[model samples]
Target: MTKATLQRRPLVKQILANADDNLLVIGGLGSSNWDITEAGDRPLNMPMWGGMGAPVGMGLGLALAQPSRRVLVITGDGDMLMSLGSLATVATQQPDNLAICVLDNEKFGETGNQATHTSPRNNGPTDSGAGTDLAMVARGCGIADTGTVREASQVAQLVKDLRAAKGPIFRLVKVMVEKLEFVMPPQDGAHLKDRFRQALLGHP
Candidate 1:
């Protein structure tokens, strides 16, 4: 298994440290939902309570709808793997304002900490020995701006790209697996939708 040193919460905090009105964030289900909420739950923040593979698609639609806003989708590796095909769709659409960051812990945190496909295989006698590289997958999907961050030093640049770089950009951040307290947003989905709509459009 790859040794991921960066912690999730601090990294998430840094990502949204200077967030502004034009920045809209979509947090995927499970840990990502908690991470963004921990960062600071705002009207512009929409944390998915149960949608496993819908964050990217939602972010893409938001980007297309609001061309002037920066739309960032923060999701887990397991969630991203479930929607890999969405990368191709995003590539095809090529929304310049859209960006995706996959927080890869190499384990499915919401599902009993199972090793995900992103985890490197042990290469046993029957193992396929295939490894998942999300950034490379994005590149293969025709996304020119893509990166994988494994060190704290690279985070400053990663933040820059996430906040201001021309996109559609894709980033995979390798984070350490540690049990953290859940920081949840308001539980109602309708409230979240209405709140986000009002924040973005001045109407619900």
Candidate 2:
């Protein structure tokens, strides 16, 4: 499977296995396909058009609330960069069961494919735009168990490693933004909110 397939492929099973786990799917609505499909039915998903950041903070709250259960956060490159400071908070709290999966596509694919701080650069550091390495940032935030994966096949192993870790683990999985841009059109009130509320309370 390719990187995109890998990022999405095993989520359902994992989510089901850890049903009791508090899942908070945050950041980049269109970046991760698994998150979108799984989120429609996922109780803990926090959908955002280009919110880009905020999942980690929410995940931290959930993790602190119920430390025993896992807090899985599905976020993106743009999301984390915008809220890199949240990592400092997460590292300080050091929630053992928390796992942050960053679907790193380099650019802000959801918004006209503009470059984010994480995108690699051909120019020098001074000339570089959005010069941030997620792995480095995670480590800099004082998270020692952070790692990045560029291959699709390594996803399961990476997840396993992160799960077994005594962390606050950050898994930055690099993906190619070949899917183009897809902006989510605004919807009417009550429909999305009601579904989200139902999901948040874990009701059918």
RMSD of each: 1.3, 4.5
Model 2 alpha-carbon miss at residue 55, Å: 0.8
Give the clashing residue pairs of candidate 1, or none: none
Which regions of candidate 1 fall more than 4 Å away from where they truly are?
123-130
Per candidate, the number of residue pairs that clash is: 0, 2
lDDT of each: 0.94, 0.65
CA deviation > 4 Å runs, candidate 2: 1-24, 38-40, 124-131, 162-164, 180-204
TM-scores, all models, native as reference: 0.96, 0.74
Q: Quick one: RMSD of model 1?
A: 1.3
* Candidate 1 positional error at 16, Å: 0.4
Model 2: per-residue lDDT, tens digit, 101-193?
887767776567887777656686577544577888889989998887876567667757645666688888776666533434234224554
Q: Kindly list the per-residue Cα lDDT of model 1 for residues 1-204, writing each as its tens digit.
A: 548999999999999997999999999999999999999989999999889999999999999999999999999999999999999999999999998999999899998999998887776566866568999999999899999999999999999999989999999999999999989999999999999999999999
For model 1, the run of ten residues with the poorest summed lDDT: 122-131
Q: Worst lDDT window (10 residues) for model 2?
A: 180-189
